[model samples]
Target: MTDYPVSNAAQAASSAYRLASLDQEFLLGDSTRGVRFQLEYQKAQEALRAYGVVSMLVVFGSARVRENGAGRQAFWYAEARAFGRIASLEGGALGGPPYANVVATGGGPGTMEAANRGAHEAGAPTIGFNITLPREQEPNPYTTPALTFRFHYFAMRKMHFAMHAKALVVFPGGFGTFDELFELLTLSQTGKTPRIPIVLVDQDYWRKVIDWRALRENGMVSADDLGLVEFADDGADAWAILKRAGIDAAPTVNNFPLGGT
Candidate 1:
C-alpha cells in the first residue's frame, strides 16, 4: 500500500473526489434530510440505551415559567421540581441495573429545568430531549450530560417522548405544551402506544383551559377516553395519582426505539 499525499490539487479539492462520509456539506444538504433525521434518532437512542434508561416519566410544562415570577409561575416551578424528585427517587431511577421511570424533560428552562434540577438534587441521572428552535433553546444543566440530546425535527422529538415514557405529568403550558400532551393522548386513544398514566397538575388551571365534559358532550371523546386523564394539586399529588394509576408496572419495553414508531 503506497500511501502518499495527492499530487493533483484540483482532484483533491473537487467535491466529487470527497468521500461521502466526510462530505459535511453534502451530508447536511436537503438531499440527505432523511439521513439527518435518522442520525438524530440514532444519536439520542443509542446514548439513552448506553445509560440504561429503560423507561421514562416524562414531564411537560411551559418554558416561560420562572422560579420567582408572578402568580402561579413560582408555584408551578416548585411543584414540577418536587415531582421530579419524587419520580426519580420512587420510580426506580436510582441504583438500578436498568434505570426505569427516569425523570425526563424537554431540556430547557422553566418547568423542564425545574424537573431536571430536582432529579439532579436527588442524585439520579435524568434525560432531556432538546430541540432546535428559531428563538434558540439550550439543555438544562441538570440533565445528565451523556443523556442530553438535541433534535431538528419535532416529530422525531415527540416520538422519542412517547416511545420510552412509562407515565406523563403535565403542568400549565401554552401551545407547545398542549401539543405535546394531546399528541400523547391521541396515541393512547388510537391504540398506537401502550397506555400510560397521565396526570395533569393544577386542576383549576386545566379545568379553566379545557372543558373536559364539553368534549364528551360534543362527542369528541368517549367517557372511557376521559378516564385517560387524572388531576393533581401539586407534585406530591401527581405522584400519588401515578401510583394509583400504576405507573410502576411493566418496566422493560426498550422504548420501542426511534425506528419502531
Candidate 2:
C-alpha cells in the first residue's frame, strides 16, 4: 500500500475542522443566535447563583438623575440611594448565604449608581445588570465586582430581570424607565408573572408622565388595571409598600412566564 500523507493541510486549516466550542466565528454566526441567547441567560444565571443572589429587588429610574441638582433631581437621587441601603439591610442581603432582595440596578450612572453606592456603603453586595448600548453603558463602581454582569440582548437582560425579581421600585425616568415599568405591569395584569409590587417614586412625576386613568376611562384598560401600581413619597415609602405587599414576607417564587419564550 502506498504511504498516505500524515494529514491534509487544507483540512487542518479549515474553520469547520476546529472544535465547535472554540470557534468564535461559528459561535457568533447568525445561525447561533439562539445559542447566544441561551448563553446570555446561562452566563448571568450561573454567576448570580454562584454569588448567592436568591432574589432581586430591582430598582428602575432615570439614568439622567444626578447626585446634586435643582429640586426633584436632588430628591430622587437621595431617595434612591436610601432605598438601596434600606433594602440591602432589611431584605436579607447581608444576612449571609442565599441572599434575597439584593439591591440591583441597570449598572450605569445616575439612579443606578446612587443605589449601588448605597448598598456599597452599607457593606452589602449589589448587582449591576448592564447592557451594551450604542452610547456604551458602563458598570458603576458600586456593584460588587463578582456580581456585575453584561448582556448583549435586551430580551435576555429583561428575562434576567423578571426571572429573579421579588419586587420592582421605579424612580422618575423617561422612555427606558417607562418600557420596563409597563412590561412588568402588563405581565402582572395578564398573570404572566406572579404578583410584583410595582412602586413608582415621586407620585407627582409619575401621574403627570402617564395618564393611566385616561386608559381606564377610554376603556383601553380595565378599571382594575389602575390598581396595579402603588405610589411612594420617597425611597422609605417604597420599602414600606413593598413590605406590605409581602415582597419580603412571602416566599420567593421564580416563575418563568410563557415558558420564558
Candidate 3:
C-alpha cells in the first residue's frame, strides 16, 4: 500500500485563505495604501451618513489648552465649550435626524474636549476625529462613542473635516491648530471650497500671532484673502458671524446638502 501525505492544520488554513477583513498582511502592505485611504474615507462617511450628520461646525484649537491651566487656557476652553453648546442648540443638532451644524473636534483633550463636552451638555450627538500619533492622542470622554472615529491618515481626516463643515471656529492653539487653520484658509482663498464662515476667537491673540496687515502689505497674501477670516471675541460673537453667513440659528430642518452642496 502506498502512503499518502496528510495536510496539516496550518496548510489547511493557508489553503482556505484569509478573508479581506481578516487579511492584515495584505491590507497593511505598501501596495494597498491607497485602498486603506479609501477605506478610511468611506468608513467615516458611511458612519456620519447613518447618523444623519449633514453639516458640521468644526472647532479647532490647542490640545494643550487645559481647563484649569494658566494664561488664557481656561478662557479658551470655556469659550469653546460655550460655542459648541450654542451652535448645537441653534443648528438643528438637537432637533432630530439629518442633524446639521453638529459640533466636531479633533477628539483629544483640552479645547477639543471642551467643545465635545458642551455639545454633550446640550444633549446632541457630536463627532470626534481622533488621529494616531507617536504621542498617542486619546479621544475625550465626552465625544459620542458611535460618532467618534480614529484615523490613521491625516489627509483623509482633514478631508472629512472640510467635507461637512458649514462653519469653522478657531480658538487659541499651537502648531497643529495653525496647520488646520491655514489649510482651510488656503482652500477658501483659492476658491477650492465654498465660502464658509471662518471666525477666529480672541482678536488680541490672532492679531499678535498673525499679522494680516503685514501679509497684505508685503503682498504675500491679497487683501481679499485677509477678508476671508472674521474675528470674534466670544461664543455669541462667533455665532453671530455664522448667522450672518446664512446659517440659521434655529432652523426647522437642515436643508443644506452634505458637503455643503
Best by lDDT: 1
lDDT, candidate 3, 124-163, per-residue tens: 9999999999999989999999999999999999888877
> What is the C-alpha lDDT profile of model 1 across 143-174, one tens digit per residue?
99998888889999998898888889999999
Give the C-alpha miss distance for residue 60 in model 1, angstroms: 0.3
TM-score versus the correct structure, for each prediction: 0.93, 0.92, 0.91
lDDT of each: 0.90, 0.87, 0.87
Clash-forming residue pairs, model 1: none
* Comparison by lDDT, 1 against 2, better one: 1
Predicted structure 2: lDDT:
0.87
Instruction: Tell me how many clashing residue pairs each candidate has.
Output: 0, 0, 0
**True-vs-predicted CA distance for residue 121, candidate 1, Å:** 0.6
- Once fitted onto the true fold, the runs of candidate 3 whose alpha carbons sit more than 4 angstroms away are 1-10, 13-16, 249-261
Off by over 4 Å in 2: 1-8, 249-253, 257-261
